[model samples]
Target: MPDADRALPAHPFDDDKLHEECGIFGVVGVQDAANFVALGLHALQHRGQEAGGIVSYDPDVGFNSARRFGYVRDNFTKASLMDSLPGQLAIGHVRYSTSGSKGQTAIRDVQPLFAEFSVGGCAIAHNGNLTNADSLKQELIERGSIFQSSSDTECIIHLMARSIQNNISERIKDALRRVEGAFSVVAMTRSKLIGVRDPRGVRPLMLGKLGDGWVLSSETCALDIIGAEFVREIEPGEMVICTAQGVESFHPFHPIKPRFCIFEYVYFSRPDSVIGGHSVYETRRRIGVELAKENPVEADLVCPVPDSGTPAAIGYSQESGIPYAMGIIRNQYMGRTFIEPTEQIRNMGVRLKLNVNRALIKGKRVILVDDSVVRGTTSRKIKDMILDAGAREVHFRIASPPTMWPCFYGVDTPEKDKLLASTMTEDEMRAHLGVDSLKFVSLDGLYRACGQKGGRDSADPQFCDACFSGDYPVKPTDMIDKGFKVKEPA
Candidate 1:
């Protein structure tokens, strides 16, 4: 079998956390736009690490694309590859495969999924999941559309191809109107760089300006990577077409209240990025403060799980007046694709990626702050590591509420039954993990951390908290059709 057909081994540590499906970046009116796109994708690599691709449009070369399985820095950084993708307009994607074949991600599934239409050739990089994709795919297939990739993103391209609309932009608007769910798309034609967000805005898309060029990215941090100025967020239900002259904004879909993913602040986005004018790092820190206020405990030191949990740990330490220490040190060089070929290495699990600070943790009542607990396996292992390091007691404080539901909006999540919180109460989880105590910030507290002072609007939420509250803004049509049960409303 080819490399694409072979199932890639899942990193033991990576299986425990939720993953964003992909990140998208596009640039127009710049020399070698693919280079800027490469930088942007590198900045957003945390969103997706499985595969990456870039599609560039040059007047001479027409449309050129390169898709590969692995990190952006590993592939896109090659001078030869960058040279082949030269263009004034380019769009790119870093994919984690939430909507397609899971472990066996084929190169064809790697996006900036390009398709030639009657009007023109367009390549699109999508950063969210389409809830109605399966049903739409079936419908299209019955109508004689041959599928190339199993990816849900292909549904959009086919939808666009079948449209009677005269222009690519109009076809896109028409196609999106028939689809349901979250999307922040960066698409490109020969002359135009297009950006769009779903009606509910369950994903993030930002517009930036670099000299005379225009940039669209999944996060503001990608803009910063290319020295682009933060222009603004592409509003929910809006689309913008960019050219050398200027940008044109349109609300192609019916208006709906925006429900941007709340988890982005908690774990998905880079710490340095800003969302809706709030710094992601600040929001995470505030979440820590809320966690401390709601679940105060006596401990000698507050220690973060490392990386994602650091900001929240700081806030928790500050709020509780406890000394903060780096009880766990992460292996900076470890990549998610590191293969564990032996049973011994597989059993080592998180130890491959993280190590305990023996001296700091020795005899200390350590309060460990983390973003969230999914399967609880990682938490149990970490607790054992802390105990082995001579810690007197181990306590877990989660910045977000228990993730009881699986996300359908472009996040890779375990089935609901597999989630630790879905089947067990807090006390049961604490006992199961062998931790002295366990607590998660309440959903309302999470809202407060996101700057919603009055807490979540029960009647109509301000953000998407589907994983916590089991209230989905857009009905997960594909899953529903597959007989997946959604939580009943209270």
Candidate 2:
């Protein structure tokens, strides 16, 4: 279904295929809520690693929406832009392209899509994908409903439109009953902020309180931005309504075991962000400790690449008796310029996202811990930068095992052919990354790091592990880009 849109360029790097699923946040009952929502969206930028948006409600003007189809800070930080947007209630979304939702003009596609229904103007922002979107859309389209965006969120809006109810909560529940997939939704009516997660709790939505107002978000990290104290996570398949009446919650989906996407703890969420009830920092630290025990590396300093790698580096340092130090400093101002137009610009790799600290790395044997390698491009560039910075040796260490297959369930690891580990031998990978030596933690090490991988974690173990094990949750007949479909025709 998405083939025409994903017609990639002939050049490998020119093809911008790898994508990310992202973060969403909503707040009701707070004055100056737009500004606070802006701050909250900033913290959850890691969840989406792509675009951001926030839409708010005004008693006088009705609804106002402003979105930056890139990072929140860079996109939403204009003095004039902030003053123009005024509201007391708001909903926000940051997106990664995990669900193959990208189109010809994604900037135009950026959302918190605003729609008008008979009841009034209601808007919705969504995180997570719907496995049943196409079918649902087909059903809706056949019923004469029109769609403005290709995103599955439209179906929810359409469903709500068909329902006959004055109360937004009742309409949302009626709509929620028709869908079955991993969806964490936050919808805003003229004056109400509503939150819902699918019954199985396939995704996450948490509730927090800031002063007397109520906040709903995909991660607790967002709440921290607005000084909102965590009240509780929105229960699986539960609907939470936040208005002047406080909150009214409901459950509408069939119950199933929670499969909270362990990868969220591993690499998806920011370390400071908690998933379900687990600490991302603590989880990565455990990974590092396990890696040290299973694949001990002899290095002078355990250093991280900054941001995502810090937690694992700390764990590795504690587990291996290696001192953890800041060997690399990030160029927070730089756009992960990996998206630049040419290889000439892209070649200046680590300098784009980060820069090495010469004082820390010069003449030192450095163990560089990172999350995972996809195209082998970023890893290679980082290694070269460390060497250029004068590290005596750059030993590469990955916290997660190699991503050998593609992920279909919400991450954009679409095909195995482009994956580094899927095709190359480990030695080949080391050579590609241009490291002095390289070692990945064993699969066992990675799992043990997860605190009983076989036990009850919020996410299921039979994850769309196609990215690592090459065994998809629901295997395809062949990789013909059926658009996340379970099997090709026999």
Candidate 3:
């Protein structure tokens, strides 16, 4: 079992926001594919900063693998390391450890996990979590399957090894059919690059075209990094096999309604990326617009919480006709290891990343726009900073609905009871944060921002708003077996 206490963020205030899951990218028919994979992973560094790994298949060299701790730019950019991994087919993964031994991530736990079988050598990188992993692991162990790493992704390799299928793709299909929950997988064999999305399509995986080669990435931003042309998103319950000859698509699972993760628009994805034809930046702006309309408060200035909150802050300003100001400036160079050893410096958490613009905040009734409040610690600290800078009042406007439930589909979230929204009402949260006022974009408003004009259909939600609405599309089987109760559908 993962040590939840140890899984806390290295920097104190880092835990104030929901951590991203993982990023998977793969390419075929490209020269020095590992180089491209490294660049793609770099673009996706926001998703997972803990570790990164790449696996490349060369005809002469066979399969080459390299996994490293820290950022991709630091580890994979070395000429010596990149030279070691030479091939035309490659897949890479950047991990934040939603599963396995969190905070104490071992090198083996890093992904693009490779396995050799009767069919051939195949490397697989996975993006989401498996809800039934615990049960599946126990069953596999009883049947004499030895585990390599603590990761749930290793289970897929073992299942594939035991499958009676003749090819890697068929075995993958077989293994996935038995597991439950969200997964956007990218696997590469000797000649083929394969991408698969789970039946629910809870996580993202998209296809891209690069000259004679093909690409599969978690988001379009990575494609843009490698100069790859945007192709369509990989459909739910669909698998695409990419080879030099052509790309082949297959639907190996029973078709179901797609409930893609709605939070991608709110925080997970890069603002510049586009998903399902909607720009993530535009969606966040729309969310801010909705927030401004729903909760119109008279304030002297609209200020963003910095980087993540900027676009929404702009939208809120435009909608409310409140002038936007850079009330908080972010220190982009700050990393997790900066002066974090001492308790006093640890307490000085949010200040290390963000500083209040005293001149702009002073004597102003500031309307602070932030993406979401996970624990309310950072919000409280930011509010205190604004007040200390001479702000008359601070009102918090959150871009997304309250996050009341933990995400089981890959996002690293605090326990149910730890979430501030889970234990407190809106008014309670406002009081807890010590803000003059607090309001969040409603669930219906969020759906409207995502292009659902009629708002979320309660009977059949268009997207997975489980974190906000507590209506999990896929049952968290492992959590349930361990006595974790889910919200009963209304």
Candidate 4:
């Protein structure tokens, strides 16, 4: 997930940043899987806030599902809702519509999508987007395969249902092999709980153990929420099946170097969660340290943009020997501006979300640390707020490199034309935002912060930085020959 922000009414704010894709959780061997799933989804609420759904199966009751277009706490916490879903094996999803397809926002599109086949029934919850979904959907529809929803995830269900494989797990592997792009999926059959990650591992998924039970979730934090001890991440291109007997693993794809999403360190994942064996909070702090070394600034105080930038700001202060101060305070209750639905509402979003502290920033030359700069709307508004607070000078430092390209796998990014960094240099952006100085951490520096000492090696990169560099590992087959603007699936 990029940020813990929501939109207004039915759509999210229209701010110039990325909206998170989704989060998935599944558990087997627990007597109350739905309860554990609810709590796990609550921990992952920051990943996606649009809607939540859970599907569970019991030997007697069969498969049951419940989906609602609201927060997990608001809908999944109710006793009635829980009563409606009873089972020992369960999988759940919290989604943010990544596509513009019609009915994408409808309740029917909310996931943990269920499908019944000759073999048995299965429910799947996906955490990333499939780049070749449209092409696959077209072929499937032409073959007379009817889709239940407009979501790309539904493609997996239909594909699996039509597979010639004998078992459900093999059918799943068969279905996945036909698609391209990122995915971290948790699925459930009548007696088995399954988890799989894309070959590139573009998304994240972890395995954990809770007493005698097993769990799979998008982040380790979800495991913590349910008292599940962290096992290991479900290996990239690996599939794990958990049942009452035990757990088994399979390699569904050919071996290759893994390229986990680098943004997970910059913005996604809870600060408390760990990714690729690195602490998210620590990675953020290291990013700040790297930024300070690469872009030195002499300022009275190091101020953070709030919550998201807090850890980085602390690291910057320590490295630069400057005092850290909370110069900007964010409102806890406001949603992100992107969901404002209107330009007028989005224009007022910054003020509603953050305010400058006159006492801390007054007459001070301050360095403001932020995670990244998307469209530059938030940065510009923040600079104005600092100026109004009587700050003599404002210097902006970004933790990650400029997001030069849009994300096609999952994260909802603005088109290239809408991205500020895509069209402007650092100096131009600084002038545009009315800041005295602006410096973004170098791409290599970002890699170093993620524990890659020699920095990004284009030959064999350690992680996915495609948004910063236009080197997408996946072919983006559905988007090619389209001038970088992949038409959404019809």
Which candidate has the top score in lDDT? 3
As for candidate 4, its clashing pairs are: 7-12, 12-339, 13-338, 13-339, 13-340, 14-338, 14-339, 15-338
- Which of candidates 2 and 3 reaches a greater lDDT? 3
As a whole number from 0 to 100, the lDDT of residue 43 in candidate 1 is 97
- Considering summed lDDT, which 10 consecutive residues are worst modelled in model 1? 3-12
- RMSD of candidate 1 to true structure, Å: 1.0
Looking at model 1, residue 221 earns an lDDT score of 95
lDDT of 3 by residue, 1-490 (tens): 4442222334455878899999999999999999999999999999998889999999998999999878898899999999999999999999999999777787878999999999999999999999999999999999999997888999999999999999999999999999999999999999999999999899999999998999999999999999999989999999999987779999999999999999999999999999999999999999999999999999999999988898999999999999999999999887656634588877777898899999888999999999999989899899999999999999999999999999999999999899999999999999999999999999999999999999999998999999999999999999999999999867
What lDDT does the true structure give each of the candidates? 0.92, 0.73, 0.93, 0.87
- What TM-score would every model get versus the actual structure? 0.99, 0.85, 0.98, 0.94
* Model 4: CA > 4 A from native: 1-14, 100-104, 335-347, 485-490
Q: List the residue pairs that clash in candidate 3.
A: none
Model 1 earns a TM-score of 0.99
Native-referenced Cα lDDT, model 2: 0.73
Q: Which stretches of candidate 1 lie over 4 Å from their true place?
A: 4-7
Candidate 1, 12-82: lDDT as tens digits: 57889998768999999999999999999999999998889999999987999999877899999999999
Q: Order the candidates by TM-score, highest first.
A: 1, 3, 4, 2
Where is model 3 more than 4 Å wrong at Cα? Answer: 1-9
Count of clashing residue pairs in every prediction: 0, 10, 0, 8
Query: How well does model 1 score by local distance difference test?
Result: 0.92
CA error at residue 78 for candidate 1, angstroms: 0.8
